[model samples]
Target chain A: MNTSSNDKQITDDLMPQKFSKSGMIWVGILSTICVIGAYAYYRQLRYGLGVTSMRDYVSWGIYISNFVFFVAISLVGSLITAIFRLANVAWSTPLTRIAEIIAVSAITFASLIIIVDMGRPERLYNLFAHGRLQSPIAWDVIVITTYLFISLFLLYVPLLPDLKIMNQQKNKNSAWQNKIYIFLGSFWKGNSEQVKISDKIINILCIMIIPVAFCIHTVTSWLFATTYRPGWDSTNFGAYFISGAFLVGAGGVIVAMYVFRKHYHLEKYITELHFEKMGRIAVMLSLIYLYFNINEYLVPAFKMKKSEAAHLAELFTGEFSIMFWFAIMVGMIIPIFIMLFKKGRKPLPMFITGIMIVVGAWFKRYLIVTPTLLHPFLPMQNVPDNYKHYFPSWEEWAITMGSLAGALLIVTFFVRIFPIIPIHETITEQNEKDHSK
Target chain B: MKKIIQNRYLLLFFVFSSMLFANRSFAQEDAGQEIVKLHYYNSNNSIQYLILESTLKKNKVFTPQKDKTYQIYLDSAGTNLIAKVKTDAAGKGKAFLPPTLKKIWDASPQHTFIVKAGDEEIISDFIITKAKITIDTLNLDGIKSIVATVFKFENNTWTPAKDVEMKVGIQRHGGVLSAGDEETYTTDSTGSVTAEFKKLNLPGNQKGDITLVAKVEENEFFGNLAAQKSVKWGVPTKVDTHFFEQRTLWTTRFKTPYWLLFMAYSIIIGVWGTLIYLVRQVIKIKKLGS
Candidate 1:
């Protein structure tokens, strides 16, 4: 296994490194975005929902869709870490921390963005007080909270050993970084007892997280499906949502892998093989999602009932037509086509494809919520003229962008603090690879 | 001497004949007695009239009572007047009597009556029978026209009237068409009164009861619409009977079983809980297998 030289390299290469010029620029950009988002949220609170173009008709706009998007992207963590680990897929070991960080950050913002979608944010307590157990929103609260805790636990358990390692290795970075490491991980004595227990607990939590992840996304889809809306009234909604979630989550991993590999020079850890494998998973999920799309659209199209006709027509040929088809082609079909090829599954091509899928899926969530609401049972009538249309205001855009940036910042900070690749798992895998050779 | 003799003889003869005739007439009349010419009229409509006669005397005191208050029973049912009355100053006064219950043997049945000083209270051991007034025809130009076959108990059958004669008074069609409109136009036997509109511009739906009312010679006719003892021809127009029926039905339906709501909630929650559990179990096994 070339233990001596490999150990030297691992110790040197895997240590928490300083942010370079580009890394600083990226952090600054993300921080600026988060700040803008905070200010925008303040404006929204003051002016009421009136600050947003969303009226009573389109009660949920971009923030809710983006929230769903973030949650969807977050599931990649469980898919890569727990699902692959249980499946004995050794290639995904190095990518586990990377995926888990993304999941944690994305789920965190998903929760936040949901609060932003609320009209009576102050009366958020009513959710607990007056919560009708039958309401999908109540179910969402229950399951999402469960998912968040499990995901957080999953992220934290794996980071304990890494935290101890960081604390032991002295660095030139400021005292604050050292303090953060001490505060977060000082309790870890690195005893075999702690390590064994931590590993067992992490395994249990990772296994628990798979179903919880499925529930969070599935229930989120139910939030739309439980409604009488034409577009959302499908039994295939849970599968549809889960498949699309895996696609976006995988796309997120691809993009994150590319970014971290380039910025950190961790090509040895996050290799082309990871990108290729992730790209294949992304493509497979995209196709599965596209198949559900056919079921979601085609069966309804066959009959085109009185209520569904207008909604379907709007997606097919009306104002939403462009966005609808664009999301399908760019998000699912194009990414599927790109990932089908070996060269396209390379890091650079996969990153571009991942970006397309993420962007497309965002629009797709928007498509899921808006078009159905616009075409209600009764014609949109007796409302203000502007109520007929829904274009998110600047505040909505800012909060949405901020939430995205916040998720990124979560991943970025997580990577900054601990090894983005699992240092222990990667070294172990590298030893195995060397032994196999 | 001759004049005194004539006066004594005539006085003796008059006293003897009056004594003998009184007993014979009283015995004969008592054998088959019936209340004849029993009819009612309300000159000033403040008082309502209910009639039941006793064959015991020419004048019977009557007491009136309401059959029911507004609740408990459906129609003024089970209510009765316990008081009695005699005839009035002109041998007639009003009594607000409870409606008759014809089911009982009428040997000494209680009937409400009222009277003034000269009126006598009478009770008879004879059966009281229902009586009705009948009219042959009704016609009101441009509004209503009917050959009204009214029934009366005469010759032991409820025979329709062969002939009818009366004057009907029509009120002026006020701008708002209703019984509230006030004026008078009389119609004699030639053309009897039905509900007919004088002006076509009047609201077609405007209606009121056409009461066959008689005038009392001595009493003043006050403008009390309720005072008229109306022999209602068809039906009263002022009352919305159906509206009250609908209101009653609505109130009764709203008292539905409360348990239905709880059952619905329980079913919904139970189904959702089961679905969550099933999905959770499936995902758990799938994760373990993976």
Candidate 2:
């Protein structure tokens, strides 16, 4: 095909399409869940956090676990978009938008879930009005806000060229869709200067986002680590959290990549090669996370200090033993074993592995937050028997699931509104490959 | 049909009679198990009163019999009624000896008190004796001692009440701390017990003043008597009222540590400065396109 025809075909293939019947059903289901979650939040606001099962001892329940999960999953944007771009990995070009949207949506809900966790959501102003600098909570607020903005810019800057392309395809979009394209990208003339400036700023953001992403999760880890609690007082917590975050974030991206590739029939662009590479990365991340898990748990188990003994025992052989082992074996070990083999790196197997990792990682966060809270340094005294254990009430579960559904809805709408794969970059890369050949 | 109706009526009558019989038996047993206690208290100002408590035992539980009335008399023959006491919700009642009993009270050193409830009477008699306690402080060459003496008025003379047991201690809000290792001290033949002060560096008021207390509690003859003496035997404590004003991690938001504030603000400004620049650059991109 001639250059002009080839470019036109790429744009035609990559432009946003209307949702199919299944897609509409998916959206409807997600909207229902979101509505349910909204009602749960309303109940939480109307009554109090008493609606949740959290009490004095197990104050940090699954809501906090969900928050950590969202924060952990958000790190994939940095991994795929910034780290891969800076490393000049050519194959990751098609997956950048998927990772970036996941990061954006997850972080958005991370902030929302925190507000839902608050008993007095109206008192949120206290965080800024009287926030103490010495508090790790204050540090987390600062870093998360900074990371969200940087991730947004990273997502937006790369889309300018694609937005301009979508705007030119006037007959393909509705009137409102065309207006949205204009409002977002009418200023993008795509001249050499604009492209140059966009490239420079994207590079700046790529570097700036790496540390901010690390700080976001590390400071979140500090929120627990700075406490004197048994399961949380390790110096290894920050690196441990960061490694686990990368694993889960990569799992999220891999899952997204597979879903988009199959649903959109972009097998030619996404390719088996992409899955193989991501599988390899997931394996490496899982192994590194496994190493850190050993460092976090094994050393403490060896000494078994009186304070840490009960917490470690609960995780290793006590009430949480089943979940603890599931998170380790399924989240890290089994995925590592699966992806290490060449046959297991296929798209379907990789997808299953990704699901395993994500589910296991969620339970891992729950185990991390709850077991330690149950085994506090002080002896459990005079509290209700229910206070000594934690299980998310229906409201907590609905709200958490709703937040998850809400995040998925955002990504789903984003996919319907914009090309899941970057049209301009894919074309440019294709052109470069053809010229080289 | 008439015989059946008569049999039915007879069965109903028997059931009601049995229920009434059982209820009356239970009431009698409860009344038989009722308990009463009387106590006398003579205050430091020489005013005296008596307290009465009534309770009933049922099913291994003691329940207060509230709103019950008891009559107090100066004799066993139900004559010379001194006062009528009524119980409150706690099953306790209080009454003072009436002015009419003054002559009877002063007529002898021994007196009898009688209390009467419905179908029950209790009598208690005791010898009334007046006693006084005197506490003295001695700091001879820094060997501080608390000496307490007990004297009883007998035969119109004050005589030493030897072998009397009393508690000598430094006074505290909750209770008294023993001046030494022993909890209580016994008086010698001279009616005095000396307790060596052994608490070291005890904190006291700004002037190093500590109140030493000597108490003869619930004595059979003396009722209860106590004396106190002030001594200078503590390390004076001066509180620092300005502690909260200092900048520290535990302080209020306005008093956050300077070093922390500086570090946090520096990091915030540096990071946000870059973000502001990036925002300005994006606006510039929009302008450039325009």
Candidate 3:
């Protein structure tokens, strides 16, 4: 296994391989979760939204928060792949496909989870039919649809040349791989003119995706901000959401980097340098996000308008205090501290920190949506006592976890088919490095 | 020659002017009780009448109701015709339409019959008293301000209408006002004008009575012109009071509810989402430059 293997041999080795024994078990577990989630969704549909622990008082719960988390994580596609390419940062070439696939899968479920949150998903056509221009839900529908198409295109256009490579060099791919490659990119000739057109199109789409990426999360923030509830009624919501989204997205990419590197034996490609750089970026994002959190929570707590005081106190020390403090410490503060050390920026520590940030961010979103609803300006009264408390029903948990597993399964299958690293981009960067030497 | 022409024109104008003045005087003299003035008085003393003109017919009975007790006979049917009246108390059961000696036949030539007290034979012939009762316009003007007047005919005398009932009222048809003899006005001539009118108080559906009457000399004939005059009166009917009461009821029927605020909030959320979507699309397209 010479590290400086010839280009043909390298391409052959790097092409996607079949699942190993653990890979099969992992797929089985994800598939099982997805099936259970689908069954839970069937029960939810049969029993109405009432099947979840949501009610009139806590009208929105884990489903909406999960949707926000998925959308936030999906932003990594733009950051790791598009932003790095536009800046001509060459080291990220190996991780670009992993980020894009993660983005595509997460956003697809982000859209699905939102539909799951809907009371009448059967009338999803109402989004187009009676869709009012003035409504924020309609806006989310329009932008989410646009973002999905753009993300799919972004992932597809770059993979065309690779697909052609796998198709022409059939010795490396199985019968199924050869079929997928031919079905996807048989028309790609890899001529200079086609290459030039593809490059120009990819560049245009990458630049276009940035603002859409920003807008998807910003509008998602406005869903809470526009409400009259004390905790959600903040002008700081949009920027706060955007900053948190970037932090979580960077964390997701780090997690993917470690897992893909260890499992696929791509340690040579995804090296310590990639981890250290991403670790530093993640730490900086966590700090920036911490700044936004302070602005979002502290400034309001200082004023403590009579309407807001009770809600603020509840998060600080009341029933919700545990979750509130937990999300802040784990999601922002701990990650910042962990990644601050030089040794902590290594692959294993960074992976652990990434997992902490991701989990903390999920609960943070839940705290954002659920607590505000519970603390509406009018006191909660006369409703069933159960309405005052929120704990996701098993059905809700199943559906939410299934969506999460579904997103991972898509990433899993994507890696199975396409080379998780962009072979052409990495070879080009490698050639440039050799020439420079 | 011009002065002579002017003098001839002036002479012709003087002749025409003198004839017009003579005609106007003649018209006023002919206009008698046919153009008598009417005023609503609070008491019988206030109802002083200067005799306009009078005409009385012989053996005529002016029975306002099915029961009557007086009768009269006229000597002639023109101005200055004299008439004599008798009462059932005096064993005479007829009355005259106009019972004055100064005028007789010049009054309308219609005869009214007084039925006897024991006249159990119900008369089939009904006389034309009023026709085509049409409500031109029922105005609620002066509804709050109107001092409702009711009247009753007394022994050989008539009292003018007076306010007796104070309660809810409509201006025209019928309403409740003050009721009792104490609320009535007394004339300086020692005439007691006791009136009773129904007082309407609430908003809708009035069911009460207000009867108005002009008192005639009770079964007695009087030659004095002042004694012959009847006091005029008006009272609130049940129908008029109902109209204004119904108006107040509708004013209280229009008040709004609490769920509308939440619906408005949802509409605002829909609008906010739309704007964010549009702004993002515009920015994306600009970045694409396509």
Best by lDDT: 2
TM-score of the second chain for every model: 0.26, 0.63, 0.21
What is candidate 2's lDDT per residue for A285-308, written digit by digit as tens? 999999999999999999999999
- When 1 and 2 are scored with lDDT, the better candidate is 2
Q: Which regions of candidate 3 deviate over 4 angstroms?
A: A1-5, B1-290
CA lDDT of B78 in candidate 2? 67
- Expressed as tens digits, the lDDT of each residue in A31-122 for candidate 3 is 99999999999998888888999988888899999999998998888898789999988788887888889889989999999889896797
> Per-residue lDDT for A149 in model 2?
90
Score candidate 2 by lDDT.
0.89
Deviation in angstroms for A124 in model 3? 0.9
Q: Which ten residues in a row have the lowest lDDT in candidate 1 chain A?
A: A130-139
| Native interface contact recovery, all models | 0.00, 0.79, 0.00
Chain A TM-score, each candidate: 0.96, 0.99, 0.97
Poorly placed runs, candidate 2 (over 4 Å): B1-171, B176-236, B240-259
**Candidate 1 lDDT over residue span B1-290, tens digit each:** 89899999999999999988998998786555333122333324233343333332323533222231111111122343322444433333234423363332132222222221223222222222222232233344534322222233445555443233322332224322222132332233432234232332322232534433322121112111111233234333455665545423122333323454365356445544544554454344334323
> What TM-score does candidate 3 reach?
0.62
Best by DockQ: 2
Whole-model Cα lDDT of every candidate shown, in order: 0.68, 0.89, 0.68
DockQ of candidate model 1: 0.01
